[model samples]
Target: MQIKADSVEEYLANVPEERKEAFAKLRKTIVENLPSGFQECLSYGMVGYVIPKSIYPDGYHCDPSLPLPFMSIASQKNFVALYHSGIYADPDLLKWWQQEYPKHVKTKLDMGKSCVRFKNVKHIPYELIAELCEKMTPEDFINIYETNLQKK
Candidate 1:
């Protein structure tokens, strides 16, 4: 169900053609709005745009060497998922977004410990998501995602 591949090419191949069209659209949305310093990458078995590991050294998650990721996206067996770590490290932002994101997204965010899942790409507000993505830089994201790691 979940996308699992070693490379971006491999990942895209796993998705059904219908999902591929949707994924391509979503991928373009992310890329068009991507801020400088951050680059398009395939992480966590999906098409994700996160701070390169070179900057954060941990890629997605708080743990530097762990498999955990800060943010990711995937075209799954049943639905599409857009994982955001921005609010994961910033509770205030999380709460704000929890209330604000729905206004545009118009779907219940399938929340996990930190990820958000949606059954279809149409349900997600890629524009709003794109805004949030654009607002933060890789260094900014790394700083936020790793904030708790520095706590005493």
Candidate 2:
């Protein structure tokens, strides 16, 4: 479920009415917690946090024209999703998130390689998300991203 919009505000405006408040809070949590160097923008039709071209001229490995994507939040058809590249790239981070999720939310974790799906907005764990956001800085991401890229 991609909302066609050019900016974060426009993207948020198109989110399903039922998810508006929770989505806003989720966005706010990410913006407030993510490190200072990451810039917020609309990327791949979602609200995204990225290391801008000025910081990482090489851009994304998959698509060098775009900035280095760190994370994204979207309201999908069935649920709201948070996509964190750091979690996908780091096994330790993934394990930590998996272990800590149950401590914050009782529901069984619904997750993908890099996406965390929140089916019930009320159960979204903002505090846990904040901790996840703080775990990596832009420099940390660039190093991890490049290190993994070289391995491939």
Candidate 3:
């Protein structure tokens, strides 16, 4: 389900009650573990962590008016989704996460290029998510992002 909210609080307020606590804890894990320089905000209708314009003035390439999005947490119809751009942009990081997921979560990894879907909120691996959040800084993301952009 897509939540159209103006702010993170509004978004959380709108999340289905079934997923609220898990979603909130996931958001907290990210917020507390993410290295300094990323800002929290509502982005693309989800609770997002981004590199503010003050940190990366150019902003996101697709929409320069917005900040550079690094991660997002959303409550979907059947799952809670955690989207991390670092894992998508960096092969080594992606490999690291894939290898690490099973150690923390017994269920098969349910993931897309960047989105990790947790159909069972109780099984969401908060600790692994926290480590993932710490894996990249804003500057590191910008470098990987730009390098990938240049290849396009």
Please tell me which predicted candidate would have the highest lDDT against the true structure.
2
lDDT of 3 by residue, 1-152 (tens): 79889988899899998888888898889989999999999999889999999999999999999999999988888888999999999999999999999999999999999999999999999999988888898999999999999999
lDDT, residue 79, candidate 2: 97
Stretches of candidate 3 exceeding 4 Å from the true structure? none
Error of 1 at 82 (Å): 0.9
Ranking by TM-score: 2, 3, 1
Query: Number of the top candidate by TM-score?
Result: 2
lDDT of each: 0.69, 0.96, 0.93
For model 2, state the Cα shift of residue 101 in Å: 0.3
Which residue runs of candidate 2 sit more than 4 Å off their true CA positions? Answer: none
Question: How much lDDT does candidate 3 score?
Answer: 0.93
lDDT of 2 by residue, 1-152 (tens): 77999899899999999999999999999999998899999999899999999999999988999999999999999999999999999999999999999999999999999999999999999999999999999999999999999999
Count clashing residue pairs in model 2.
Answer: 0
TM-score each candidate: 0.80, 0.98, 0.98
Candidate 1 lDDT over residue span 95-123, tens digit each: 87788776886567677756777777667
